[model samples]
Target: MSAAEFDWNLATVWETIAEELPDAPAQIQGERTFTWADFERRANGVARTLLDGRASRDDRVTQYLRNSPEYLEVSHAAFKIGIPAINSNYRYRDEELRYLWEDADVTAVVFHGSFTATVGALRDRVPRVRQWIHVDDGTQPCPEWAIPYEQAAAASAERVRAPWGRGGDDLFLLYTGGTTGMPKGVMWRAADMLRQVNDVSTVHYALEDGAEGIRRDLRGPGQAHISGSPYMHGTGYFGATMAMHGGGCVVSLTAPGFDAAELLDSIDRYRVASLAISGEVFAKRIVDALAAEPGRWDSSTIRNVLTSGGMLGEQSKRALLEHWPAAAILDGFSSSEGFGMGWSLATKDSIPETGRFAPGPNVWVLDEHEQPVEPGSGVIGKLVVRNRLPMGYYKDPDKTARTFREINGVRTSVPGDHGIIHPDGTIQLMGRDSLCITSGGEKIFTEEVEGVILDHEAVTDVLVVGVPDPQWGQSVAAVVSVEPGAAPTAAELIGHVKARLAGYKAPKHVVFVESVPRSPNGKADYPAARALAEAQRQPVA
Candidate 1:
C-alpha cells in the first residue's frame, strides 16, 4: 500500500490487530494476561467511562501509574475516544509534577495508590484536574476523593463507538527536556503516530506483506516480550506497541524500582522472546546477575535484545555478547518527536566505534548553515529530520519555529544533536550540541570523552561535562562508575582518553561515583552531571 493510502489512525490499527489475532495474548503483567479481544473490550469500557464523564475530543488525561495492564488499557482507551493521554514520568517530584500537570492542562489523572502522598501534596497546585482515580493493587487504601480503578471499569459502558476525528487529530503530548527553558510538550497527531507504527512494520520489522507473514515466520502463539524501561518514555511505548502489533505478549514487571534480578526472573518465567533495555546500566546489571547465578535462569527463549536512548558503551556491549551471543542486539536513535531515524543490528564484528549504521529516510546530518554536510568531511554537524516533523512545540511558537525550520525550501527539525556523516551516509552521533564546551580555545564534545572512558576495562559507566576553570573558559570533567572494588585515578582516565583521542579532549578531572543519573528514557542526565561538577568546584572557606 502507498504511504498516503495507508490509514494512520490508532482505531484502525487496533481494529486490524483485533481482527487478525483476536485470541492472541496482547499484554502480560505478572500473572495477568489479556488477549486481543480482552484488550479491546477493556479499552472500549475506558472510552465509555471517559466519554460519560464529559471528556471532549483532544482533552488531556495524564497517567502516573507504574508498569501494569491498566496503563495500556488507559492508553488505548484514550486513543479510541480521541483524547490524548500524557504519560507522566514517575521520577518527577511534587514540583515537577505540578508544573507538568498545570502546563498540559490535564483534566484527569490516573495514578497508582502508592503515589497518593505525592499527588495529594500537589492537589491544590493543579487546578485543571477534575477527576482523581487510583489503581489499588489491593494493599493501598483508596482515598476519599478517588475512585477505585476496578469499580470505574465495571461501572463504565463498553463497546463505545469512536469519536469523530480525522487521522491528524492529536493523539499524545510527550514532554521532552528543554535546552534553555522548561520541558516542552511535542504534540503528535494520530496519523503521525500511525506513521510510527508503519515505520516499525515496514522499515524496521520488514512486515510489508501484512500480518500473515509475521504470524507465519516472526512470531508464534504466546510470544513473550518485555520492556525494561519506564512506560512514560518513547522506547517503552514503541516496544509495547510493537509487541501488540506482532500479536505477542508484553510482560511488564512492576518492581518498586529497577532490579536486574527481578527483570531476569520475569524473563525466565515467561520465556520472553524479546527484551528492550535502555542503557548500559540495565544491560550491565543483567550481565552481572547472569554471572552470579549462571544456572538459575533459562534465557534460551530470548532472540532479540533491543537497546537504545543512550550508549551501551563498549564494556556493556562486550558483556552482553559474552552472556547472550546468539541474541541480535539492535540499537537505534530516535526521539519523542516523530523522527524515527537510524538503526544498528549488532553482529559478531560490531564495535563501539565501528559498524555504526546510517539514518533512514527523512533524516540528515547538516552543517551549521543547515545544509547537508559532505561525506568523508569528518566535520561534526547537527542532526536534522525532514519528514512528518512536528508543526511546533506546544504553546511556544517562536522557539518551535527556531528548532523546526525550513532550509532551502525543505523543512527540517534539528533537535540539538551533534553528529558526523560518513562517506557511506552513516551518521556517528556525538553528544548534544547544547552540551559541547569550549576550553582553552578548543571545542570538545562530551560524548567523545565518555566513549573513550567507557572503553576502559575498569569503568562500568561514565559521563563527561564541562566545569569552571581558572584559565580555560571551561574544563573537561568526567564522572564515572568503576568495577566493584576497582578504583582508577583521574590521571589514569586522562591518559586513557589522551591515548585514543586528541590531547585537549582528555578530561582534566575525574570523580568516581556509584552511578550516573539518567533521564526516564536512559539519556545521560548531563544537567545533573554538570551540577555535580559545579558543586565540586566550590571554593574552600
Candidate 2:
C-alpha cells in the first residue's frame, strides 16, 4: 500500500515491517530474541485466541506483566484486533488493581505467573474479565482458569482481521498516575499517536506513501534500544513503540529489580544505541556503579541516553558522559497526557540544568486569564500542548473536559504542569501542581496518602508532602498529629499506609508533630506544614 493510502494504524505499520524485515530483531530479553516474523506470528496467534474467546472491537486488554516481550506482543495483538490495551501497574496492590481494572472496564488480562495468586484472589470480583492469559516466569503455575500465553501464541499463525476491521481511530488506553482519587485512563487514538510519534521522531512516516515509508527506513539491522523503566509507565511503553516504529530492537532487562550491572551488561551485549531511563533515579545508580568500578563495562555502542517522567540533573548527566562521552543525554519533560511538552539535550560540550527544557513546538504556558505567558515575564503558568493529543480520559467526561479544553479557540491539553517560559524560549518547569509529589518518577497525591494515614486509630490528622532527596527526585513525607494518649512509631504509620496503597506511595519519612498546622478556616497550611516536615522529617531507615 502507498503512504497516501495508509491510515496510520499501528498494526498496519508493524505488519509491513514483518513483511519487509522478517529476520530483523524486534525484541530481546537475555537469551530470548523475537524477530519481526516471530513477533507478527505470535501476535497473530494471541489475537486469534482473543477472537475465539469473544473479545470484541475496542475491548480493553490489561497487561499485568512486567518488562518483557509479552507486554508488547499483547499490545500488538490488541491493535490487530481493534482492541485498546490497558497498562496495569505491577506495583499495585489488590485494591489499586481492582480500582484500575474496573475503571478501565478491562475485558481481557495478560499477566505473569508471579501475579497468579493475586489474580486468583480477585477473579470472582471482576466478572467482566472473560479471558485470562498468563505468561510463565517459572515462579508459579498457570491457574486452571487462565490460558497459558505460550498455548495462545501457538494457537494460530494467520493475520488477525477482526470483523469490524481496524483503523487509525482505534484506541490505546494509558492510565495516568492517580493524583486525585483514582487513576484515569488517557485514551489515545492510533492516528493521533502515530502523528505525535512522527512529530518528535527522527524517522518520518509519509502518510501519502503508506507502507513504503516503513520499507524505506528498513535500512540494515535495526538499532537496539534498551528500556529500563517498567513497561506499565509511559516512558517505557512509548520508548518501546518509538523504537519499533524505526524497525529497531527493543531490549528489556530481565532483572526483577533495578540492577545497574544488568543494564550495563545488556547495553554491551546488545550494542544498544539508545538507553531510555526515568531521570536521575536510574542515572544516579548507573553513575554510582561506574564510579565504584570504572572501566568495568564496555559502553561504547550507546550513542543516546534518554530520560523522562523525572529530571536528570546536570551532575548526573555529566557523570554519565564521563563514562561514555559518545552518548548524548536527552531529558524529556512530559506526562501521560502530554508527550513532547519540553525537552533538554546534554552532551560532552553542553549540559543544561535539571528542570530546564526547550519548549516543544506546540507547547505554551498560559496564565490565569488563559493568555499566553510572555517570555521572561517571571510568571508561572499552566503548561499546555496544542496538537496530536489524546482523546481524553476513558468513561470520565468531566475530567476529560477539564483536562482537554479550548484555550484561545484551539484545543489544548492542560495536564496541570506549571512552568515559566524563559526569554530564550526555554521552559523552567516548576513541577506538577501543589498536591502532587513526584518521587523517582512516580506521582503520589498527598491527599491520597494523607487519607490512608488518617485511617490509623492513633493518627488524628495528617498532611503529606514531598521533600527533596538525593536519589528519588522527591520522597513522600508525612506530618501527623496523634490522639492525646496515643503514641505511634513512624514505622507503624508508614506500614498502615503501605498496606492500603502501593509501597511507593507510602511515606519515606514521617514527622510526628503535636498537631498538623491548619489555617483558621481549617484549610491545610501546606507551606508551614512542608517547613515542619522538612525540619523534623526522619528517614524510614
Candidate 3:
C-alpha cells in the first residue's frame, strides 16, 4: 500500500478499525471492556456534546482522567471534532496545571471527581475554560460547577458526523515534563503523527509483505497489548493508538499502582501478546514475583516485551530473558516531543553487550558545529532529528528556536539529547544535553556516569549531577540508593566508578540514599537531585 492510500487522520483510522473488527475489544479497563463499535459510538456521542456546547473545531479540550475507559473515549471524542486534546499527567500540582491550562487555552476539561479540589483551585486561573465535566470513580465529592461526564455526553444527539478537515489538523497538545522552568506544549499534526506508525510496522517490524504482513502478524485475531505506563505519556498513548489502528485489543491492567503480580495476572488472563512498560523496574518486579512462584501463571501468550521511557539495566534484561525465554525484549528510545528515534528488535542470538536501536529517517548525532559525526569515533554529540517533528514549544518561540535549530538552512527539531552514532549505524543515547555536566572545561554526560555506577554490586540506583565548585565550574556528585543493610562507603562507590571511567568523570562526592527521585515517565529528576547535592555541600569558610 502506498503512503497516499493510507488514511492518516486518527478518526479515519478509528473508523477503519471499527469497520474491520467492530466486535473486537478496543480497550479493557478493570471490569469495563469497550469494543471498536462501542468506542466509536461513545466518542461520537462525546463529540456531539462538545459541539452542542459551542466548542470550535480547533478548540483545545483537556483530559485529566486516569487509565480508564473514559480517557480513551474523551481522546477519541476530541479527535472526531477536530479539537486538540491535552492529556494532563495526573501527578501535576496546581501550579503546573495552571500553566498548562492557560498555555493551551483549554476550552473544556474532563477530570476525575477525586481531583475536583485540585481543579477548583485553578478555576480562576484558566479563564478560557468554559466547561468542567467530572467522571466519578467513587473516591471524592463532585465539584459544584462540574457536570457528570455520562450525563453531559448522553444529553446530546447520537453520533452526528462532523465534517472537519483531517490531514493537517493539530490533533493533540502534549506537555513536556519540565525538568527546566516550565513545561512546554508540543503541537502534533494528525497526518504527520500517524505516518510514524507506518515506519513502526514497515521499517522496524520489517514486515516482508507490507500490508499483508501487517494484517497477518500484527492485527491477526487475538492480537492484543498491555500498557503499564499512564496514557498521558507518549509510550502508553502510542501503544494504545497503535493497537486500535491495527485492529487489536488494548488490555488495561486494573492495578491502582505498579504491581508486578497484577501485571502478570492481567497478561495471563487477557492473553496479551504485546506488552509495553516504562522501564526495568516493572520487569524486575515481574521477574522477582515469578521467581517466588514458579510456573504459577501461564505467560506463553506474551511475544513482545517493549521497554521505553527509561533505560533497561543489564540485570533486568537478563532476568526477563531467563523468565520469558520466548519473548522478545525490545528497548525503544524517544521522548514526548520527538518521534521514535531507535528500537532494539527481538533477536534469536544472545543479547549484545551494546543496546541496538534502529535509527529513524533523517536522525543523526551532530558535533558542536552541527555536523554529523562518524560512527566509532569515540566522540559524543547532540542528537538531532528531522522529518515530521513537532512545530515547536507552544507560546515559547525563544526556547523553541534555541533547542529546535535550522541546521544547513533546513528546519529541524532537536530535543537536546546527546549521543554517539556507533560504527554500525545504531545510535547510542547518552542522555539529555541539558543534563550534561562541564567540569574542568571537559564535558561529561551524567547518564554515562550513572550507568557505570549502577554496575557496582552495592548500588541499587544512582543519579549523577553537577555541583558548584570553586576551581572547576562544576563537580560531579553521585546520589545513590544502596542495597538494604549494605552501607557501602562513599569512597568505595567512587573508586568503583573511577575504575571504569576517567578520574574526572567519576563522582567526587557520593551520598547514599534510599531512592533516586524520578519523573512520572521514569526519567531522572535531575533538578531535585542537584538541589539535594547543593544542600548537602559544606559552605566554604
Candidate 4:
C-alpha cells in the first residue's frame, strides 16, 4: 500500500491483511479455527446482513453476548458498514441491561440465546432497537422475533462496497463502569485509537513511522496471542485487537467463565506466543494451577506476559517469573478512557513495584488545583493524558466537562485516579476514588454491590469495604445489620449476591451486627467500616 491509497480504519486494514495473508490463522475459539480467508468471509457475511437493514453511518450496534467469534465478527461487521459497536457486560441483570441498552440508543443487538429472556423482556422498553440478531449457544431457544445468526450470515463471502467507507473519524465506544453508579461510554476515534492503544500493545511489533509502515512491519511470522480475561473487557479485547492489528492469531477462551485449566489447555494447544491477564486475581490462580501439578501443561511457547487494566502486584509477578522463567512480564498503566500514561517491564533481572510505572512523554500527573505536580512532592493527584486522548464521554456533556478538562487550553482525560509522582519520575498508583474496589483487575463499585445486598429479605443495612489480601489485591467484606432472629449465614448471603450482581463482585466475608455504624447525616463512615472488617479478619488473640 502506497501513501495515496493508505487506509487506516480497522475494517480496511484487516481486509488488506486478509487479502495479503489469506491462508494464515486469524481466530481460534476452543476447537474452532478461522483462517484469514474464513474470518474475512464471515465478517463480510455479517456486513452484508447489516447492509440489508440499510444501516446509516454512525449508527450504534450493541453486542450482548460473551466472548466468541461472533462477537468479534459483529464488531468487524459493524465497522465495515459504517456503524459503531458497543460491548455490554454479560453479568448485568435485567435493569442494568435495560439502562445500558436504552442509554446507548442501541439500533441493534447481537445477543446470545442465554440472554433471550433478558433482551426479550426489554423489547418493549427500548424503542430504538429495530433488529435482534441471536446466536444459539443452547442455553435457551431463540426468541421468535430475532433473526437467527445463521440465516443473517448466508450472504456472499466477498466484501461489500458502500457509499460511506470507514475512516479515521469513525467511532469505537468503550463503556466503563467508573467507580460509582452506571457505566459511561468513552469514545475513541478509529485512527487515533489504533496507533495509541492497539498498535503499541503487541510485543512482536516495533515502532513504525506510519500506518503503511506498520503494515509492512506486520508481514512476518506474526505472533499468536491468548487472553485469560474475558474478550469483552479491555484486557482481552484491546490485547487481542493489538495482535490482530499486527496480522497475528488471537486464541480466545471458550469457557462460559474464567477457567484456569481451560485457558492453560488452549495456550498449550495453540502454542500461544503472548499471554494477557489482569492483576493478582488471574496471576495467583495461574501460578497456583501450575504449582499444583508441575509439567502438566506446556507454557514454553509463551514469550511475553502482559498485565493491565489493574495493578499486578510484585508478589504475583515474582510467582509468575518463578514458573515461566523465560517470559518477559510487563505491567501497563492506563484506563478505559485513554492510554500511554505509564508502564513497567519486569523480567527475572528486574521487578517493578506493585503500583509503580515509568512515566514517559505522553502522560502527565496533575494536582488538585489542576497544575502539574512536581515529581517527589508526595502529593496524590489525578492521572491525565497530556497528549493524544479520547474525544469525550459519548452523549454525556456534564460528565465530559468534569473528566475531560482544559488545562492551559489543552484538553485531557482525567481518569479519576489519585497517585503519587516519585522523584525518579515513576508513578505510584493509589487506585480510583469511587468507593470502588479492584479485585483481580475487575472494578467493583461499592454502591452497586450495596444496592444488591440491601435487596435481600433477611438483611437490614450493609456497607461494603475492601480489605487487604495476599491473593486478589483486595477482598470485598460486607458489614451488615440483619433483622432480629434472621439466620442468614455468610454462605447464604454470598449466594444471594452472586445471583444478583456478577459473582466476582460478591463480598467474600459477611459480618453480622445489630446495627451498622453510620454518621449523623446518614453518610457511610467508610473508615469505621474498614476498621470493623479489618478487626474481623484478625485471629482471636
Candidate 5:
C-alpha cells in the first residue's frame, strides 16, 4: 500500500492485522478466548449496531465498565466506525458520572450490567446519550432502554469500513482523573498516538512499508500480555493496545479489583509472556504472595514486568526480581497527555535507584524560562515531551494553552511534572508541581477531598496534604479542626470524604487539630499543613 492509500489511523492498522493473522488469539478472559477473526467479526457487528443507533463520525462513545473483553470490543467497534471512545472511571459517584458524560457530550455508552442502577438513575440527566449498550455480568438483566452487548456484537459478521473513512485526525479522548477539580478530557489524535507507540513502545510498524511492515513484524501469534490495571486508565489500555498491535492476546483479570494470587495463577495458566502492573501498590502484593507461597506458581514464562503511574521503589523492584530473576522490570515514566517522557529498566543484573530515569528521545527538562535545563546543574525543571503529543484538553482551551505550548518553535506537552537532569543524561523525577497526591497510582487532589471533609457539620475547617508512605508513594492526610463544641472522630471525617468521593481520594491519615494553618488572608499554608500532617501521621499497622 502506498502512502496515499493508507492513513495513520489505528483502525486501519488493526484491520490489517486481522486480515494477516486471522487465527491468532486477540482477547482472553479466563476460559473465554477470541481469535483475530472472531475479534474482527464481533467488532464489525458492534460497529454496525452503533451505526444503526445513529452514532456519527467523531461522536463520543463512553466505556463505563471494568476490565473485560467487551470493553475492547466496543472500543474497537467505535474506532472502526470513526467514533472516539471515551473512558469513564467506574469508581465515580453519581455526580462524577453526570459531569463526565455531560462534559464529554457522549452519544453512546457501553456499560457492564453491574452499573445498571447508577446508569438508570442518571439516564435522563444525560439526555445527549442516544444509545445505551449493556454487557451482562449476572448482576442485572438488560434494561429495556439499553441494547445488550452480546446481541449488538452479533448484529452482523461482515466488516465495517465507515463512509467517512479513517484519518490521522480521528481522536481518542482520555479523561484525566481530576487533578485540579473536575476531570478534563485530553484529546489524542490517532496518528500521534500510533506514532508514539509504534516508535517507542514494543509494537514497531515501519510507516513507509505500511501494511507489509505490520505483516512482517506479526509473523505468528504474538506474546500474551496481561494487566490487572483497569482498562479505563492509560497504563492498562496502552499495555493491551501494544500487545494487540504486535498480534498478541490481551488478557485481563476477571476480578473487579486487583488480585495478586489470581494474577499469578492466570499468568501461569495462560503462559503469559508479559505482565503490566501499577507500581508499589501491585508489586508489594505480588511480592508478598510469592514470598509466602514459594514455588507455588510457574512464573518462568514472564519476560517483562511493565509498570507505570507510580513509583516502583528500589525495594519493591529488588523484591520482585528475587522471584522472576530473568524478568526485566520496565518502569515507565509517563502521563495521559505525554507518553514516553522517560523510562527506567531494572533487571537482576542492574537496578537503578528510585526516581532515576533515562529520558525519552524527545523529552527535555525545561526551565522556568522555557529553555532546556543544563544537565548536571542540579536545577529542577518541568518535564516536557516535544513530539507525538495529544491535541489538548478537550473543551478547555485555557488548560490546553497552559499544558501544551510551542516552546522554541516546537509543540511541547508540559504536564506539570518536575525533574532534574543529571550529567549522565538521566532524570531525577521530583513528582508533579500541582500538589497532586498520587497514592497507589491514583491522582488525588487535596482540595477535592478537603471540600468533602468540610461538608461535615462538626468540621469547622480542614486542610489536606500528602505525606510520605512506605507503600504508596504519597498517602493523603487531612488536618482538620472541629467546631468549638463538636467532636468528630477521624474515622467520621474519613468516612465523610469516602462517601462523597472515590475511596482512594479519602484521607489515609486524619489528624484533628485546634485550627488549620492559614495565612492572614485565609490562604492555606500548604507547607505548614504538610509539616503538621507529617509530624502527626501514625504508622500503618
Candidate 6:
C-alpha cells in the first residue's frame, strides 16, 4: 500500500507490515518471540475461526487476558474481520466484569487461565455469550465449557476476508477511565483513530515509497518497548500497537502484575528501547527498585520513558531521572476519547514542570461558554482538541453528544480535563475537571495538591479529594500512604502542601492508609479512596 493509497484501518497497516517484514520479530514475551509472519498467521487462524463461527462485522469480543501476546493476536484477528475488540479490565470482580460484558453485549470472551473462576461464574449470568476461548497460562485449569485457545487459533491459517470491506469506519472500543464512576466505552473509527493517534499515511515516513520506506525504516535492529501498564487499558495496549506498527517488538510482563525488578530484567534482557508507564505509582515503584539496588539491572538500552493514561508528577520524573539519566522522559497528556494533545519532555539537563505540556498545534482551551480562552490570560478552561477526534462513547448517546461536540464549527473531544493555554502556545494542565473539588466557591484541582504532597520525602503515594466541611462546604482531604521508616504527621504533610501551594489548597484532613486503592493497572481508584476518606472524618468547619 502506497502512502497515497493506504487504507486507514488497523488491519491494512498491519497487513502491509506483515507482507513487508514477514520474518521480523513482532511480539516478545520473556524468552519467546513471534515474528510478523507468525503473528499474522495466528491472527488469520483466529479470524477464520471467528468468521466460521458466525461472528459478524462490528461484533464485540471481550478480552480478559493478562499482559500477554494473546492480547495482540486476538485483537489483530478481531480487527481483520471488522470486529470491535472490547478490552476488559482483568482486575474487575464478577459484577464489574458482568457489567462490561452486558454493556458491550459481548458475543464472545477470550480470557486467561487465572480468570477461569470469574469467567465461569459469569458464564450463566451472561448467557448470550456463547463462545468462550481460554488461554492456558499454567495458572489454572482450562474450564470444560471453553475451547482451548490453541485449538481455536489452530482452526485455520487462511486469510479470512471481511465481506464488508475494512476501513476507518471499523469500531475500536476503548473504555474510558472510571476513577470515580463506572467506565464508559469510547468508540473510535479505525481510520479516524489511525489519523488521530498516529499520523501514518501522512508525513511521518516516506509514504511515497510505501512498503519500501517501511522496510528501510523498520528493517534494522529492533527497537523493543515494554508497556508497564495494563493491556486492558488504553496506555499499554496503544503503546503495544504503536510499537508493533513501527516494526519494533512489543514486550509484555512475565508476571501478572507490576514487578519492578521483573520489568528491569526484561529491559536488560531484550535491550528495550522504550518503557511506557501509566503514572506516579509505576514511577515510584521503579525508582524504589532502582534506588534499593542501583546495579541490579542495566538500563542503558532504554532511551525513552513514555508516560500517559495518568499524570507523571514532577518529583517522580526527577526520581526516574536519577535512576535512568540517559532516557528522555515524555509525559503525554491524553485521554481515551482524545487523541494526541500535549506532552512534557524531560531530559537529564531539563526537567519539565509537572502537568505542563508542549501543546499540540491543534489543541484548544474553551471556556464553559464554548468560547476560546485568550492566550496569556492565564484562565483555566476545558482542554479540548480541535483536530479530528473519536466517533463517540459507545451506546451512550447522551455522553457522546456532550463529549464530542462542535466547538467553533469543528467536532472536538473535551475529555473533561482543565488547562490554561499560555502565551507561548504551551498548555498548563490543571487536572480533570470532573474531579475538581469546590470548597467555599473556590475550585481546587486535586492533582495540584496531590503533586505537591507527593514531592515530600515521607510520602509514597497519595490521592487528594474533597470531604464535606460545614464552613468551607468541601475541604481538601489527603489520602496518603507514607514511606517506610518515616511516619509523616498529618500536620507535617499539610505543611508540605501549604509550603508549595496555597494554604487553602492544603488537605484539611489526612487518611493514612496501608496503601492507596488502585486498579490492577495502578491507576487511582478515586471512588474507593473518597469512600474511605468520607467514612472516618467527623463534621469539620
- For candidate 6, write residues 145-264 as lDDT tens digits: 888888878877677677876765788888765666787888877766665534621124454454456666554434788999987887788777777777677888888779999999
| Candidate scoring better on lDDT of 2 and 6 | 2
Candidate 4 C-alpha lDDT tens digits along 308-335: 7644556667778887778998787777
User: Model 1, residue 4: what's the lDDT?
Assistant: 49
Lowest lDDT 10-mer window, candidate 6?
Answer: 200-209
Q: In the order shown, what is each candidate's alpha-carbon RMSD? A: 3.2, 10.4, 3.5, 10.0, 10.2, 2.6
lDDT of 1 by residue, 321-395 (tens): 777676777777777654577777774466545225568688878887767789889888887788787766788
All candidates' lDDT scores?
0.74, 0.81, 0.74, 0.75, 0.81, 0.79
lDDT of 5 by residue, 322-385 (tens): 8889899998988888888888999998988666799999898988897889999977688899
Model 3 segments beyond 4 Å from truth? 1-8, 153-158, 163-165, 201-222, 346-349, 353-356, 485-488, 536-541
For candidate 2, lDDT tens digit of each residue in 350-407? 9886567899888989999999999999787889998778889889899899899998
Model 4 earns a TM-score of 0.79
By TM-score, the best candidate is: 6
Q: TM-score per candidate, in order?
A: 0.92, 0.82, 0.91, 0.79, 0.82, 0.93
Model 5, CA-based lDDT: 0.81
Q: How many clashes in each structure?
A: 0, 8, 0, 0, 0, 1
Per residue, candidate 3 scores C-alpha lDDT tens digits across 229-312 of: 778777777777666667778877665567778888888888888887877456656777899899888888888877887666
Cα deviation of 6, candidate 6, in Å: 4.7
Off by over 4 Å in 6: 1-8, 200-203, 206-221, 537-541
Which sequence of candidate numbers ranks them by lDDT, best first?
2, 5, 6, 4, 1, 3
| CA deviation > 4 Å runs, candidate 1 | 5-8, 162-168, 178-181, 202-222, 352-355, 519-521, 537-541
| Cα misplacement distance, residue 90 of candidate 4 (Å) | 0.3
